[model samples]
Target: MPPETGLRIPQDNRFVLSNARVPTELVADPPPGATRDAEGALLLDLLVQNGRIAALFPAGMAPETACRVDLEGRHLWPAFIDMHTHLDCGHAIPRVRPDGTIHGGFSLTAEDWPRWTDEDLDLRMEFGIRCAHAHGVSALRSHVDSETLAYSQRHWRALDRLRAKWAGKVDLQGVTICAMEAWIGPEARALADLAADMGGILGGVTDTLDRGENGTYDALGQALDRLFALAGERELDVDLHVDQTEDLSAFTIPEIAKARLRSGFKGRVVLGHCVNLSLMPPEVIDRTLALAREADLAFVSMPTPMMYLMDRKPGRTPRWRGVTTANEIRAAGLPLAIGGDNCRDAWFAYGDHDMLDTLKQAIRVFQADEPLTGSLAMASRVPADLIGRPDLGRIGADLPANLVIFQARSLNVILARDQADRIVLKNGRQVTDPLPQHHELEAALGLLDTAS
Candidate 1:
């Protein structure tokens, strides 16, 4: 059947997606004798029903009674999963000053949190999630600040509401971001317990490591012990924000590995930032990567925000790049995923939950240009694995019908285009109007672009 001029998606979760140019590499465990053509494209049709992928058939072979939507030979892949983000805190307005440095960003966060009303929080979070969904992200793990007990609990309640609201459209996971001292206290424990009740992850920042980098790391190590203990007790995963600074010697990745080993943590351990880890000498970096691998630690790179925050000194140009050791970490065979950490927030202004934009920036910063360079996995495949959803982002029989159809033949074309044309589907139905904020969203995105 021919597609209509505008969105021709069916309201029911039953349809036949045809004329898709699926990549051979994205198909997981294809049937015997299945192969791609000379151009690495598999012209296939997907049969989706009851919110799941019923089967994969050859082009023009789907049942005639089912509603059909032609993909126009566009590339089809699994919808992206953003493994790390600060959704609850995403701001559409410019939060940081034009002359702001890293310290200024941090100060802005502390200053902004108290002023945010419940309605403002919900508005921003909803806008961010909607943007993510529109851009083909089906699942995302957002870190919410868990400072004071009351504040953290309120944010969790707000997220729960959003999660329930976006249930089938997007799977929203929350992580309680707390301070090191919180882990050792009752307030933090209550916060972690609440997070567990809400099916959220436990996380904290380890900035105290900067004070005792050369010493025994007694305080930070003890804090990790408490944090992991809470996680183990709550039966939740661990995600930490660590070493988000330009101090080259303030490395916490190694100590985190040691703490993981000491605690016998077998659950998923996700660490973000580690900017100082990027500034270390080659030998030290190798050693740290090895330790991290031994401890089974997965790294999340926030390139745009990290780049904006790192190595800023008044009246001086940045001498170092603000990126984690992506190449070295991948070389050590560790799981590495990249994320759009903050969106138009105080941390670093400007983002709209576009994973392709994130991937393009990462490709340039980390120089992962080819299939051999391991760039693709950082956004799609690796993030799915890190989020424990192996069934996502792969073409195969008997998977959820969540998928993305990019209007490009390959990644090169997709990245080169100024405006990306794409279709986002949940359960085989296209998302024509995902935003609830309406025109306010446009104004917000406009503000973000100007702020950037």
Candidate 2:
């Protein structure tokens, strides 16, 4: 169990948080004499005034204030940003994929989609959003299944309601996830317009599912050209599920990059789950990354779900880690983020919408903790920037005092266990909301037995 600290704050929203261990890189314009510990963490006293960060002073140098909370060297970070998620299909546990493969998951989810009423979607999406909020997630982008216009409208409306309800708490953004071929016709333009009306991003999947039917790379390029043109016309950003397969032939990331360069689409392009890049040979990987750099492509890796769903075989040991080339993507100077892709859905059966947990999993999977100075930014600043919300990710003066403070003093201690006892401060006030009960969802989800 984690030790308890008295987390009370004053009524006037003026306080000093002393001895907080924050990542050095996250601190912007630090005061003179601000010092870092051995692990490149700044030990500082942060002053909060009128629900904003007034300044950061060196440890023990803060002026006497009306209220003071001693963190006792606990780790503090900006609230997390989950750049990729599937909230519309979230919490459909026990309706999961039969064979634990990508195709199986798709089929299973499609079979279950007919049962998704508006109320059902609202309950599940609200639950997911509340889970994310309780876990210190300040912003998230969810990919809604948009195989048909009717289905897409329903989900987008449901998301819009939740977006309004959770307006200040969780910054919610939605993306339409469809097949690449779906973007080739007049309906594609309609879908893009719908996304713009809903203030959402345009997105699709570029996998063997579409490539097999589209017949050739030329057709795929034509489809991508149309997709980018529609997005450019609507002034919407593009987020895609690209190359999420183990087959060496399933290399669509490069083509997508080429299409981006060819179309001259100036909007932001984010590619998710380029799992095949990990299996590609060095030359192919180099070429794909070069194209990505030239196209200004950003990436978000869904490590947990990819690890669970990729490279599975019956009665055989799994050989590969189903993740993308995270290190190389980061090395190429591209904006790479880590996302918690699915939760209790057909695609994956685990996850609590916790971005800290996602970051910890990413660190273990990608070996991202060696330097420890900037790794936390992947879940915070990087995704926040990708989502166009720069104010939510870093700790700086004049920013809102939205932060999560943990009992652990160092990153290693945080990685050793789930920091469930974290204190979430929004606008310099504590959020004491408890996690939603599983029983609340039991009736709607038929989860009575699963809850047991």
Candidate 3:
């Protein structure tokens, strides 16, 4: 199809095309009989101008612009959305004892990070982002350490710098996955204020210090209210790192439900790692589902880290589910999503940096049928919208050009061969990025190659 007369996709954006064997059902095309020419495989040539989507071509049409690139033998899909991750505090260089066995995030020390310069921080951040792109992750809500004295204020500042540096390249959710020790006392309020002012997040936690004065349901509830109020006052989003446990009686997440009901905060919120939701008996899961639905809460199941760490703990044979209840959550008409909690950090050990792997894992672990239903949506527009990502998921005219190209014929193949590399497209042009730089840690920890 020729460029329409008097129609232009602005001179600033780049034009991109992907031609491969994408599953028809997964990759929706304009109606087969839609009146248009220039039809090709999954035609919807993205025109990304000014770092945003400018236009889309239909029915095998080519862009009139000369600055166009074609990706051959690759499938295009919505980029993955990783809704949960710790950005600055975890990833570090491989260390070893005098005997010389390498260690990763588990051995990472706050001292090591301060030894890094601004350039070093940028490299680390860039490496993480590149890893995400290689595995088809477009947007991420990365949690940074803002309240920790070791990092002090540096991690949040690093995140801000990285956000500006990689703004147009990929959508970055600069959030504060705050420290557990900093949640109470006078420092907590100030830290919360800083996170809100810095365009970061006020990440709440429930299972950090045990059921103490500061860790009880009542204590956690008050802290959440105060922090949420601060976040509201600053007009910031709240992404809580709640219960990563199986002992239902040991915790009380209903307070989260109560907070939502009392404050009615439905905007820009994410409930990360509700692993305990699975153990909540049918009645509790049902009630929580009702509350999450009422609050318009988005549940993100970071299957990788959540499952890996929980499995390693004793008396904690994971039941219900390692992630949250997907079937019940979705059926409740709530905005449910998924994220790769950790890539190569000690918090997690087996993430491939690919949500495709997450999807495949979700099927067997959660009893989900393969070739996921509303699957891509879990890691695409759903999370993208939550973090204010501008149209990076859907393939439509005027959406962002952050896209992925795969070599597989269908979602089934993609799921079966999770790590198979395929062509990639970013901002309407082909690009290359890799997954987490600290994967050697997982290997050393022996977390990979498990049944998960």
Candidate 4:
């Protein structure tokens, strides 16, 4: 098979990844439940057997029973896990105008949603997943817009089919996304129950709230209470879009933290965006962080989309950068991750579902371009934990042999290069082909064109 079909692999389950650079320590410690060798560190040839890392041997030594393929000193990183995305919406050139603002993006998305067909959605989603897989993401959590309870149920069913089809190759989890108000009442409770029944997580957006207004606080608190109640009732985890705007009135992180504390909800909560944190008053920021710590919340920052949708006022050069206060979050020891959100959709016009692309953008936006700063944790280790897969992101004995082999000598060189010469391994096999069904989407979108 051609390399594009997937990287060529030798026969047999046992193989030696020759001359690979095994890390002495993860940039961050492995999340709770990760498996490691007795020494827990090494630099040697990785021995993979029956789709799990078997052992590490010194370079140039090949076991008689195993196949050997040389990495030739290329850098190796664990496969990526995207903690948040909207791939159920999939990739489309939005019909409505993109005015380069958040509202404009939302308007475009709304206009585009009703036009989606089952076939079209499946094709586009397959394309997006293949793109992410090619870039070395093996697990992902994709948010499906729950416009209504019925639509959300149908979306989860579709995701279930996709999940079965891509089993072992990629793990896809669905998140039912809606406004906080949608989580209220009997009908909403049924919806949340259906989502859990269909193996989907609970999700809601709390991006609208007034800081000091009594009525606003009451309304917001009621909505959050209902949301958390549904989550607790369904015994489902929650991923929220909170404070995605920089407007001071839109700050909802503090309220969410307080809600967690009040409800005493012990389920895992993942928050996305929190862009207002970058612009909040110092005292408010401190309070919010302290509350988040108490609530044990994790944050997923979508810098690429945030940078695109935020701070856009026509004819004005924006003074504020459109990203979260990442430095402060990291300094406070929060489990902060960066994700590839809204790829080629109305919310963002670009992206191929590449975690490295997102991580690179995060480095620039958050000024995390320092050695041993755990920047890669945004896509790899931290997200693995957020998605509750402590077993996936670490490279060690007894770990599943999912790995990304970059054909670069160093991290800096990989960052500087185009990174086309890379291969993804899933359970010791190379992924060579995109889905055959993706052809229709490609043709319709003019992506098959060889000439510009």
Candidate 5:
């Protein structure tokens, strides 16, 4: 489907790919051999109008619009859609422990609960948004803990404020990260109710049972019942943070998968992590893959955190090696995508909200020969398809004006770097550049302690 008429798209209808060879068509294995072609594989001119793709012609294309820019010697792809990024939203990252149970630089219990005030949330969110945009992320799914969701009548107002703040430039999705609080029964429902009111997907913690011992084995069933019922009543989308640990004992995933089956959820449901399967016995991996395919369940792997979070014991290879092999997962026939779960929140002092880094890590880890195309799909097509926005992921006539232009000549060489200097345009105008303002987010949070 084409974007709605009358939106801003770059009028730069002419450009060239010097020595670049676009993926033109690769077999897309959403479920094993289910492959498809993406025509016009290489050199082209990408035209934009009203923030959607207006025209794409070979090398030089004539334009009815007088504005056109040459993106010679650069690469252009669809704007990235990060399916997961915690940002500084939750008190979750920055953990002093592997389980993310601690607060900032020091002790137990973390930051003050009241620290999540409007200014705090807004400030953190803005910093995150700026970082994401700079990283070429045009759409994002970020979450604040359930504490914020329970108090959403007061807390989540930040999302509305944020929507107003960056309105036309970004597409945002907020979830009530309820794993820590799901077994609370009524309180959890209230969070779901709040999410329903706000109009977006409700993300659940379905893997808590086997995780930190704080969550019940049956807690998932209870939470899913409450959440699914409420979402059913309200028609909300479901995105579960599934199988978060290396413990093969975690049974919540199957429960949630069964729930999705019972609920008749097709594309509206998403599964975030199944890290255990990354190292699961081949038979187990095979069965799980089949289940996911049958469930129409989508996967979002946090490359940095998953690689760092699990067991590293010699005998623990099955679960701790890393949760996602982008290439393997794709070959498994599962719809997959990548997300930067950590924005240097403390627990994970690594990620930069840059998908490029995530892609590089995936290539190294997965040994993906076609890393660029793999990373681009993980950040674009897969996420877009998962979210019901296909028009925005491709570059062609009638697609959304959401596209990315990278300041690089080759994919392999570009991703080999630690960061990328790129431009993200929503409707035709550049809205973000991640590299130039890398420290902006950290500085904003008083993370550097500049603010009191």
Candidate 6:
């Protein structure tokens, strides 16, 4: 165990955490005379009362308290939010992709769909949620596969049960994902109703594979229009997988923006992936970004899965990083959030649903640490706002004392290592449960023999 694990915190709900380092950006209003570290993080004392932040005091200025734990400058962060994930399909690694390509992964997942009974889904989904909670994520939004009504209902029921079970620990939200073309029929209305019933978001994919052959941009536009109309009717926010392909011609982001504007849909719209945007011509990229700005769309980039699946050819080292134009997206003054897209499933063979790991990879992949503080927001405040939960991602007075305390005191130290020894606290209490073991799922997932 790590040295920090040996430090005991007060079990009572009220206490003082002295000399804690918090990111300046995450602190709503710093107390006067607050001192900052080299990376612009504020050093302060945080008071917790009844599981919420009571107040913040400049280091060494806090009032006397019955219980005080001195962190001595250890970093503290608000619990993270992973706004884009696929928990319904998580941890089916036994159905690994054969060729290590996007299509191969899709095929394998489709073939394995029959194995997703309620028992199998509950076990795998709960396992992913536990991993995330242990790693200090307080909220997450998952895109459930909704190819058919039957499959949609089955998984939604499983998610509902898990949502209730994990309440107060992890705030769970679901979104329905299918091809945009599937939303052009009456089933679209049905799905929208189901999403609203569950307090979920409407989602679909607008990729080249989903679009019909021979430059069917017109049909794609109509499909998006119908999707937005359905979402508007139900007052549901829309999240779409857009242009996740290497083909430069596969630019569906512009169409989505146009559809959003044409439909006059006032609800929030989120566009995920858009890797082809990086491959587009400068003018095309500029035009698409302009449209996205007008539509006020949010972007979520899942670099881990995209890097693993995109631009892969047998025996050829991948040349380009399979990520969207992250810098450009942020520069456009649009919301950009990082997501843990897939975890140990057919779409991705590795992940533990850890947002810290996700943010670390994103910083390296996107060079997002220029300011460091802003990059951290991509995994926290940005996603929290996108999910319509502004109160969940920042450390402030009156907010729940959900946090991750890292032994690393500087930004460089935190990013250089995984911080696996970091401490997680929910509702002002340290989470002592170990991460759920993989062997626990062996019998449920039929991976006993395949276990390594």
Which model scores highest in TM-score? 6
- Candidate-wise lDDT, in order: 0.78, 0.86, 0.60, 0.76, 0.60, 0.87
Candidate 1 residue lDDT tens string, 253-340: 8778899999987789999988888778888988888888899999999998888878777788888778988887888999889999
Candidate with better lDDT, 3 vs 4: 4
Error of 4 at 189 (Å): 0.7
Candidate with better lDDT, 1 vs 4: 1
lDDT of 3 at 375: 58
For candidate 4, the TM-score is 0.90
lDDT of 6: 0.87
User: What are the C-alpha RMSDs, in order, of all predicted structures?
Assistant: 3.5, 2.1, 7.2, 4.2, 6.6, 1.7
Off by over 4 Å in 4: 1-8, 23-42, 57-65, 94-97, 209-216, 434-452
Per-residue lDDT, model 2, residue 138, is 86
How much does candidate 3 score in TM-score?
A: 0.78
Which has the greatest lDDT?
6
lDDT of 4 by residue, 172-199 (tens): 9988888776766456877788888888
Question: Candidate 5 residues 1-452, lDDT tens each?
Answer: 12222223344543222222234431121112221224323555555555565555555443545555666545677777777876434322332223332223223214534566777777766777766676667777776556444455655678767867776666777766665346356576677777777766677676554434655555565566667777777777777777676666774556776767777654377778677666567777677777767777777887777676555454445344566545656887878787878665544655667776776676666666543455557767778777766665656576666656665556655666643445566776666343434345446545544322
Off by over 4 Å in 3: 1-58, 61-74, 96-120, 149-152, 179-184, 209-216, 313-321, 432-452
The candidate 6 region of ten consecutive residues with least summed lDDT is: 1-10
92 Cα displacement, candidate 6 (Å): 0.8
Against the hidden true structure, what lDDT does model 1 obtain? 0.78
Identify the runs in model 5 with alpha carbons over 4 angstroms from their true place.
Answer: 1-22, 25-41, 63-67, 88-112, 180-184, 210-219, 312-320, 325-328, 370-375, 432-452
TM-score of each: 0.90, 0.95, 0.78, 0.90, 0.80, 0.96
Tens-digit lDDT string for candidate 6 (55-145): 9999988889548899989999999999999998888775454456778767888888898999999999999999999999999899988
Q: What is the TM-score of candidate 5?
A: 0.80
Q: Residue 218 of model 6: what lDDT? A: 77
Candidate 5 residue 136 Cα shift, in angstroms, is 1.5
Model 3 Cα lDDT, one tens digit per residue, 309-421:
66443454644346778778877887777777665444553445566777667666766664356655777767767777646566655565666666554455666775455
Better of 1 and 5 by lDDT: 1
